[model samples]
Target: MAYKYSIGHLTYTFNDLKTLLARATPFRSGDALAGVAATTYQEHVAAQIALADVHLDVFLREALVPYEQDEVTRLIIDSHDAAAFKPIGHFTVGQFRDWLLSDACDTAVLKSLANGITPEMAAAVSKLMRNQELIAAAKKCEVLTSFRNTIGLSGRLSTRLQPNHPTDDPAGISASIIDGILYGSGDAVIGINPAGDSPANTRRLLEMIDNFRRQFAIPTQSCVLCHVTTTLDLIEKHAPVDLTFQSIAGTQSANASFGISLSLLEEAYQATLSLNRGTIGNNVMYFETGQGSALSANAHYGIDQQTCETRAYAVARKFNPLLVNSVVGFIGPEYLYNGKQIIRAALEDHFCAKLLGLPMGMDVCYTNHAEADQDDMDTLITLLGVSGCTFIMGVPGADDVMLNYQSTSFHDALYLRRTLGLRPAPEFEAWLVQQGIMDRQGNQLPDAGTYTRLLGGIGQ
Candidate 1:
């Protein structure tokens, strides 16, 4: 019998799937309950549901029972027919894992379950899945999104410039930026964090980046990641604001620590959007987030740090930022204690944000006090690249003088491109070729005296 029906535009039926599963040997493992092999669609559905519940119970009791928190438990669970447990958020990370593993859940159910949980809960549950599984989910979630109109992401890999200087000195910072561009990095954006947070210092830095771009005829944008109010002030004074930068937190109270209210964020977004300053188009915002910011501000509300971090994305989405990255390891040893934690958090953060339809990148980096090294970063960068990461931070020698940390360097970007056969953003790649930094084939021009020529007359 043909078991197909149309509900609105979608044309698939539960009975058809049940019948198919009944006949499919792949679904009839010895582990499946007796008589579940499809005498009827209703019986098959019941067996599958029961088996899924068993998986949830075992997983919750074993894997996630210990780390269970009350706040998480209080969060909603997106189940049809009201999960036996009220407020699915109360379900442990293990339970989320169980639901994800059940394979019985349709796309709508998956999204509903994801909606009821916090970003951190999503992140923690992600830690239970294998890398390939997470990557597959990310691939299918390729949303038709655009930011900067320069850096193409979602199905593509990209990189960025963190041309930071210790004293916020424009000349010294310019040198680092030139080096980055000459090496064919910074397609995402030439975003810098001012060592000094004052509005005056921030303006000078912004102007300097803008000047370099104009002088070299570089087709890209710049950002001075000072406080939002300070950037807003710069915008009022008519400073060069290509992308407004802010450090957003998950909770309102945590955001208050940064002096960022939702209203203030809206003000900044509206202000920057009106400027039309971005090189590609005027979708101008850059935000950086980390797992520990809420706790650092003493505003975690007893939620796990990762969930708190993910909630920050909701704030970012409001502005439609050209770039939004989780500086995953920058917060140090307290929240994410080591390399293992950092890697897992990095993957989880990227996965969750992308799932939420944000152009997510990862600051695959670590502080000196954190128990991580170059090897761990290499692993993360590769894994994230494979998972279709939008971008990663490209610094000098893998170190940020201003931020006082290690990160992926310009050469690292090249290595990813070469190893994975990836390319920089189209416009930026053309600029690199025109500058002779990279050949037409996207290969770096022979390093013979290229650096000397690129840096010539800079100090003078």
Candidate 2:
């Protein structure tokens, strides 16, 4: 169907829902590259105005991707809870935005609405919201998940201790992990991005991290961010698999580009569940998604990057993942060209995922080739902190030798925790205090030498 809006002597028309969404998206390079972005600022605003009047029910009827061709669309349609949507079912996209920012949409209310709010609905309302509105609405939604430790509790911000090495060297990775733990990071999980995808190498990395976690008796889980299939094989081999990891996208075709399918992911989830690795809870999946992943694979089907990214959260939500993050700027300048665009994308990703009741976090990062720097990261991290983000990455020195990107560092986590008075996961915090690494007030104790004994045989 066609949609149009008029401004005095000027009129703008969108050919379809996909075109309306694409033109309404905040300016980004990927949309332009795909030849879907609006050609002028006026046209973009007009599209937004038209989109604001779209009723929430329209999305349920006209999917951007055909339901017959896409399993993702099928999953979304089949799982929707019509009863849960009754209260807000009459709202238009703009009215939904108003309701989200209103006092009526408290934590409990948003939690109750999660199953009813589709990802497309979330994305639509987000387009009509500003940065602070995005943060304000998301702040009201609390999504807590657990494994060996709990995450997403109020007054807490978790960090993934990412000790990535270019060669997957055990010593180098061990050193990074030690640095992260002492600095009050790693409450989310100690996850590593291996240099190779071979099953043997992936198994070795998982076993090494598992051993380190066990040796310290740290109240945290460990993961080697390998392909889901490789992790499944390792689980079969009885390697200590804490979380099954995968990079997923919005569309089935995009996921296929990464060598995954819904069925394959379901298989991995069931396989990992059999291990019963968690003492606290059994949320065993860790998923990483980013904007432009679908477009990068030529599979977005003309939807805007932000909407496609939001759709990926539906996939994460189905798995009940322990951790789900958007590596916001890691795809580089082609998708999110600069700091401004990257920051907006991160905020939108967080807000949409939270609305859908996913435990949303962000990898506040950028590539050197992109027009961004640490100052941009600092701005984003501060915003996410106040927005009640579940976790962030803790790479040593904010640089990943393996992935060759600039991410938040162990020190960055310390800065945010100190600035915002946030603590790590309760269980991890207790371990930190017991080991003399941190005080009850979330401050790092200045006695580095006292914790050297805890390193034991690591990095040897």
Candidate 3:
């Protein structure tokens, strides 16, 4: 394209990620640093190609073929749980989808390396390798720094994202699709997604979070699930006084259970193995938040699955989760309707933080309403204000994303990146044009000045 954002600063968009990676260092053969995984190379590739709904071949042609396996092998390892280093029993569908969802090497290349790899598997594997140099290029959290002129950094940052779909490529494999995407240079993120069925997961994940050392852009998964006052107090105690927990959840999967009350769930969570607070090298996390899933007690939020889960997540982060998700329905400005109970539940977590992330942008209803677009955005702003959801996103598929960050979509399985944007769309062309995203010509970005002025100090 147009390369609009590249002319100056604020060029943080999905396209940039692809371009940067394309120009990034290439991987070398047999690089052990290419992220430790539970599955073998062959098994990993087979699963990547067989994932459901993924356009694997198309992704390979577009993003991978230009690079070599050695270049590709240097992938981001989302979690460093010992389980990741363990072996997989078989390439089942679940394993395949999970592996594919990761931003790692292609399944095709993985299969090619195996002795008895099949033709079908080879076709699926494609060419696989890590820009092994990329791994070395990354300056760990200790060294990652942020540039004042440009947003990309080498250390930690407040950046966040909410992706709309899974990448159809292996790059998606190494990166935790559904978790946080640590963008700025030396940085990492922390959050939970209710997937840890083990007691020690919190410990294991935190360790990995601390281990990702490199320079330049960094985005990775870091989480902790906690809800009850006691659990919160414990974390606080460990913090002010200093403490840490080493997770053994991956090793304690069988003990995880679905419960009915908050106390029971809390007990179950507390029961998980952990290092005493103050222990060093504890990075990856799966904190305790009263589970929001049906089997657990915290699921009363009003919206559908997306908001309900995200709402609880909001509380786990002490109420103002920097990033979150929501589900609202709209056609345009004059016609916006939301689920009230959901808003209440999410807002209830306001004490969570100074800023929170709302990976919102799901329309439960969409029709040809004239004022639908504006109504949707305005209402969304109002809802977010009340809900205290901070990090915003400008989703591409969003029928209504006035700007990128107040914010949100997703299916990549975890939270990742904060898309700072204010672009135009045409699904509701007439309505949006009236709102200023478009001009009389009905084409091209309105203008750099107009786009910036639109958010008007709401959130820069």
Candidate number of the best lDDT: 2
Pitting candidate 2 against candidate 3, the one with the higher TM-score is 2
* Backbone clash tally (model 1): 5
> Could you tell me every candidate's TM-score relative to the true structure?
0.74, 0.99, 0.26
What is the C-alpha lDDT profile of model 1 across 1-460, one tens digit per residue?
2234343574433233223222221221111322223444444444333322232233232221123432222222212123433346445445655555556544445444433333444444554566666665554444323334455443355677888988988778878887787778787888888888998898888887777676667777778888989989999999988888888887777888888787888899999888976545666778889877877887765444655677687677667777789998888876666787788778777877776556788899999998889999999898888877888988998989988999999989888888887787777777778777898666888674656655663433
CA lDDT for candidate 2: 0.93
lDDT of 1 at 180: 84
After TM-score superposition, the amount by which residue 332's alpha carbon in candidate 1 deviates from its true location, in angstroms, is 0.8
Displacement of residue 8 (Cα, Å) in model 2 is 1.3
What is candidate 2's lDDT per residue for 115-174, written digit by digit as tens?
A: 999999999999999999998988888999999999999889999999999999888888
Every candidate's lDDT: 0.67, 0.93, 0.25
Give the winner by TM-score. 2
**What TM value does model 3 have?**
0.26
Tell me model 3's lDDT, rounded to 2 decimals: 0.25
